[model samples]
Target: MPVHFSLDEYRTRVARTVKAMAAADLDGLLIFAPESQYWLCGYDTFGFAMFQCLVLSGDGDLHLLTRAPDLRQAQQTSTLSDAQIQIWRDLEGVRPADQLQDLLAELGLTGKRLGIETKTPGLTAYNGDMVRDALKTERLVEASDLIAGLRRVKSPAELDCIRRAAALSDDALDAALAATRAGVSEGDILADMQGAVFRGGGDYAGNEFIIGSGEAALLCRYQSGRRVLDPQDQLTLEWSGAWRRYHAAMMRTLVIGKANDIQRRMHDAAVEALEACEAAIKPGAPMGDVFDAHARVFDAHGLTHARLNACGYGMGIAYNPIWVEFPMFYEGNPMIMEPGNAFFLHMILMDSENGLAMCWGHSTILSPTGVERLSKHTLDLVEL
Candidate 1:
């Protein structure tokens, strides 16, 4: 098996998950989240875009029900034996959920109270409905947060992967900074950045690197077109370095030439907010308090109108479409920060009134002593 963690580590994870399932009063769990599956047994695959499920019984038995294509995928990447992996045929009237039901019957889990992960990209509504229809006789409850909560705190091995990813993130940023200048195309900067990560033995990021210039610099998400940098232009970038499916993300808004007064003020505010957030993110602190600190700093600087509602979120063991994880920093979130918790906190300021954007962000791991900023880059404004 190409499992990254030791057999003992995988066993411990399975034990903890089984304990959580017991606490939830579930007889078994239908884990649909690819991240959850990967965390549990190193079952890595994008095949989750289709119908695939990992059934974890109360006694800690794992059985993966997937399509034919992922049979070898699981065999090569996961710790599962060939017999433990059940192939669900794609016949005209057949549904994977029905195969899951049969597998459950063989495992004697039919009609038992089951927990289903319904809030992931791996489980679309169409498939969810089919699952409900197939397992109608069984008592199913939503249990997405069980694994999510457990995965929030990184293990030592997981942190090592994230630390390497963080270094790659810094390297990518340095490459992008060196490649960025007047007359340069966004494509060239992107190529340099991604190439830096790949050259460092990093994996593809969970999502496309967000790159925009000029007016589009205000965008926080990736969009379709690309453009060259003007002599005096603004560029915003949001990217992550992934290793072993774990991500460490960073965000920045760079000025091609000299930064205007408004942009300078916004950058200062972003830096201040980011620092304040860093100070607030510690063991025993509620995640909401961190966001509150960010809000107060930005509002104090008269940049409340330009600030993002949420400051950041946990990042690790991610898949396509996004790298954001649980314990999101927002108002009234009571999730407490604990040691080994890794998160990416981005302070973004998009001033539509002035048609400018400024941002500062990096990943950090919370330790018992204090917050450990992953990126080695300074917060100074990058003026190319």
Candidate 2:
């Protein structure tokens, strides 16, 4: 039987996280957000409206407080056998927060310093205040930084999942690029790409694949429209294949007609920048250094100002879990490239007088010496 993360593994990871929280002087951590809940409990439920909360004590005790109907599903999926499950039915005028307060009191956490996940946007104002009022003796602290720090580095298991996702994404990009032609509509090309992902035993693309032609290609993240490709235009296709809910993205620019001198120049520049970025990826390499490499390539071609962000972030474990983005140009962020970290390297160059050209690739599992390009597509300009 194939197991993703065993119960023992989850318990060990949670123990480590809780020990870190205790070292930071937190008595107990309350994670009400979905990602945090899944991280700690290995229980994933759809919809943000579902009221599910995970509470972990400094002693490594775990508890799940949720609505009554969800209790069975939570128990079935969670790795924590000892997880105390609490169910509540809202009575006249009683909010879900009130139920959480009762659960906290039951756990005898009245006076302990409690840490709350502040990232969940759907937390109600009344619930926030109720938690504070209920735990009258303890101070409420935000644990976003503490949790994010732990989640940024990928584990070996996480890297493996992302590697599979990247492979699937690469296959999808190949199919999409192959299906693209002078007369094909953007919609048809997108359908072909998505179909490839499904046929390859992966789920749908995690995001909308942007299949833009001609002027629309300049829009960077443009969605596929009714526009049909012309022999003289360029088609830029951006998409990813999702496997086990993890996503890996790839983008490429294809010229429909014989490339003009200007188009060829811009494509070469973009490819050079992408290659430079790929070469710069290594453990302990500053993310800024990688960004500067791409920037320098564009500057040498006099298209520095015409570029969007040099590259984009780590992909794996689905940003659905924690939303950790590693932008190349993020100022003062001292995150060095580390082994097991996956990133998307996108090189975008748009010359107003000509057209837009882009090269997107995936790099998963950066090693001590270098990084791995998970994308298997040819980086050279593809002419349809």
Candidate 3:
């Protein structure tokens, strides 16, 4: 198999998952999340857009029920044997859920307590309804975060991928900075940024890069139009690097020709807030503490109205649509800071009064003694 992790590591992950299922008193898991499938057995495929599921019995038996398109995909990328890969035909009037029922029956899991992962894009609400109808059993329960909890703490091998991804993220910023100049189109800058990752043998990120300039800089999400930079403009960007599906994200707001007084002040507040968040990431501390620190710094600067509600979020092996991991840095979040946990800390301030935006962020991996900032780049505001 062309899997990223070793066989032993894969076995260990499966073992951990099965143990969790046992603790929950689950007879099996109807796993639909692509991340869970990849993390469990290295089943790499975007075929989850269709009706595909990986069924894991409590005894550690694995079976993948997917369409013909992903048959070879599972064989080439995952640890599953040919027999373990069950293809559900797309014939007219055939429902995949019925096929899933048959598959479960064959595995002696019929009417057994099954945990379903419902909080992922892999299982659309329509598909979920079909599955629920076919199963027709109250044994199915929501266990969306079961695998996610285990995934937050990165193994050494996973950390290796995250570190490489972080380097690629830094390189992308360098490429963007180098390409930035007056009269440059946002398309050209985006091309340079993504090209840097591809040149470094990196994978596509879980989501599109956020790039905005001038008035659009106040917006945080990616939009369709492209704009050329003015002589004096503000450019806000948020991007991530992916290696073997693991992501390390970063964000920044760059000044093209010169920065105004409000922009400079906002940048200073963002920097101070980001640093305060970093200091708050101590071992055993609540994830909310980091956000608290960010809030305090920004509010103390009298920019509370301009600041984002949340500071940051955990980052890991993510798929398309988003790269945000759970236990997001919001007020009152109780997720603990532990060694091997990777998180992205972003301090974003959008001042509509001045029509300006300032953001500073980077990814970090928590260590036994301290948190290690993944990016090699300095935290100084980039004035290009």
Candidate 4:
């Protein structure tokens, strides 16, 4: 069953967002992308090419302007019961600029600081120039970072959904490992993994399942192919499960037969790096410290050259949500690890000579004392 968040909870979240917007001195925000719309109103809609916008005023009023076909669907999914929904008739004739002008007039904001999601609208056919000319307002500013800062912290209900997603992913991966064997094709293993996720009541995988065998595993993100597995081949499987749009990812490597000394050494290094990264994920700890810990592990194993691919990202309602990868691996990101911040710490190692080795794990909640590992699956290398 799909978990439903309370209307009051959503309303409170929107209120907090609105307060933040007001503090940023923005009179209104225009959200056109799927992720922003879902974040603001808990509503997901199709037909993004149709030029839709959800206008959120500083005074806490919500108005959705979209094409005719999406009104019912938006209303059904939206948590704001009293939000007004409007529609435009034709793409060129209805003029998003003119409609936005009228919306601004209705909200009585003729000369106010208007904020726009520059990243989202920039990808679409809607011209900001047309809207600026129509409204005669020059207060449009980029609000991507501001919105992202607001969404970095997750609520308790959101964390629960993520935990469930992680559990399902762990279960599916265990089943996939059991089904893998010496004679199984890479494609067959991927198909079985997907089936396991579905049987566990998951809606979808966060990304495509990767089943790379032998030389194919040399690629960090090798996709599944028709090649049959051999007794001496090494296999790597990367996949995740989704529940109510939240994602939980897991990756594992296995040897069909006994692993060579080089493979075992690489695998051990990856496991140690993964453990070090996981240990550094407590509240108030610098995120850079976690990355540095992994880097040291790779260095200790004389695998510093392979450290470029050693990192992970944030996970959540990924398909239609913004600000998923918070505290990313960039220089000078001083965001501290908070209790509700979910992150994945992946230690991926690949060499042209030895093949691929990876250790992936995640934590949905970072407590004051320690962190909670969302997926409970063992990290040991499986022998088929």
Q: Compare candidates 3 and 4 on TM-score and give the better one.
A: 3
Candidate structures ordered by lDDT, highest first: 1, 3, 4, 2
Please give the CA lDDT of all the candidate structures: 0.93, 0.70, 0.93, 0.71
Candidate 1: tens digits of C-alpha lDDT, residues 261-365: 888889889999999999999788799999999999999999889998899999899998788997689998999899999999999999999999998899999
Candidate 4 lDDT over residue span 1-384, tens digit each: 111678677788779878888888988887765655666667765556557777889888888877778777776777545348877777546576687778778887667888877565322534655666676764787786666566667788878877888887787777777877888877777777778778877766535666677777655564534788887778776667777667767777778888777777888898898888888777887778778888888899998766564377677665532323555643345677777877876677777655556545554467666778887767676677
Error of 2 at 254 (Å): 2.2
lDDT score of residue 236 within candidate 2 = 72
- Lowest summed lDDT over 10 consecutive residues: which window, candidate 1? 90-99
TM-score order, best first, reads 1, 3, 4, 2
TM-score of candidate 1 against the unseen true structure: 0.99
Decide which is better by lDDT, 2 or 3. 3
315-381 in candidate 3: lDDT tens per residue? Answer: 9999978999887999999999899999999999998988889999999999898989999898777
For all the candidates, what are their Cα RMSDs to the real structure?
0.8, 3.1, 0.9, 3.0
lDDT of 2: 0.70
lDDT of 4: 0.71
